[model samples]
Target: MELSFQTVLSQVMLGLNNGVFYAILSLGLAVIFGLLNIVNFVHGALYMLGAYVALLGYTMLGPLLGKPDFHLNYWVALIVAPLVVGLLGIGVERTMLRRLRKFDHLYGLLLTFGLALIIQGVFTNYFNVSGDAYDGKPESLEGAVNLGFMLFPKYRLWVIGISLLVCFATWFVIERTKLGSYLRAGTENPELVKAFGVNVPLMITLTYGYGAALAAFAGVLAAPIYSVSPVMGSEMIITVFAVVVIGGMGSIMGSIITGLLLGMVEGFTKVVYAPASSTVIFLIMVVVLLVKPTGLFGKES
Candidate 1:
């Protein structure tokens, strides 16, 4: 079969769309690891919860609010889900993660892993393995635009644009701003930052919340494209982790660039050989590991 230019272009665009989610999720992971120095295994579960919250808000909450005619739309989910999940993240960090901070890192990992399993289990029991569909899209973003080369969905373009914007905003805040400077300084020497009058503990909690919020934001964005399911995060978290590994944890810009690039590579792989699409990113990860164990942008310890 002769491959058409439009087909390839569309696939590339789709890949880029997927990459936005990867970038956001990995960026969250990078932020959390950079500041908190703990691997958050429950991030994917939080991502799943965000989608479920948006789903519930759209289908159940809207009707309960006496507005069945105008159901909760994507915009509402965009705002509410992150706040809800971020608050949940704060609770988790303060109540559980804080106590484990004095112990080995494995304790934190195990605790989060258990939390992920618990979250997934509860949702699975109620929602079952089959996915629930969220059909709400803002009316303003209902159509596709013909870009001469390809007809792209406006919502997708919005997603890509917004994701990039958020990613850059996050980068700028962490790398160039005063608050960001404090965060960087805290990560290196928490005692010193604390001695200088910074509330290091509170900052750590908020950083975790912010990371969770990022995951939730990505979930809300993804709800329109994928079904909201208990296992959705589990399926994607491993890939996002690989993206972090290939990009290097704690490197914000590295996470963003590697994610988008890998997404493009995966999309191109699908165009050339459909079966290898799933493993392409992992293959790249392996090669990167062999060549540079610290990752493309990671600094040597």
Candidate 2:
């Protein structure tokens, strides 16, 4: 089958749309794992929570409170959902994760995995299992913008821009700044950093919250692109885990580049063989693990 350049570009753009989410989600995973040393299996459920929070904040919240005329707007939902979810993350870190600090990594993973299941179950019982359309797109981003090759939705462009900015800013914060130095120092030697009067436990709590916030941020972005569904995160998380693995756990730049690159690869595969796109990332993950168990950018501990 001969495909035109426009068709190829279109798939590439679609791939990129998917890629941006991968990049953002994986970035969060990397952040949590890098600093906290916890495998956050609940990241996906938190992402779903972000979307539900956005939808309900704008739709059900005002009415439920007998203030039907006062509802959260898209812009407000964008900020509120992440904040609320991040605060919830803070709670989890403080109340649950802190208790497991001295335990094996498997314990943390199991805890988070159970949390994800419980969250997903609760939502699935109450909400539509298939999906719910989110009509939360702001009026300002209602139309498509011409991208020379094609007209793309303004909301998608916004997602692309915002996700990139957040990812890069995070990378810079952790890699370039003085505070980052402290974080790294605390990661390396928390007791020593604590001796310097740095609140190491507080820092760890904040880091986990930040990572959860990142996942929620991605969820809000995705709310418009795809229907809000409980299973949405479960579906995406597996692929994202693959992305994280291929990029190397705890590797920031590696996750970003690998997410984008693999997205493009998945897109190209769709054009070549529709059936293979779904499994291409996993295939790459297998190969990468076979060659370097540590991952592409993951360091040997």
TM-score each candidate: 0.96, 0.97
Writing each residue's lDDT as its tens digit, candidate 2 over 204-252 gives 9999999898888888888888999999989988999999988887668
Q: Write the per-residue lDDT of candidate 1 for residues 115-162, one digit (tens) a residue.
A: 999999999999957798888877788799998888899999999999
**After superposition, candidate 2 runs with Cα above 4 Å error:** none
| Most lDDT-accurate candidate | 1
Cα-based lDDT at residue 31, candidate 1: 94
Q: After superposition, how far is residue 130 of candidate 1 from its true place, in Å?
A: 2.7
Predictions in order: lDDT: 0.90, 0.89
Weakest 10 consecutive residues, lDDT, candidate 2?
69-78
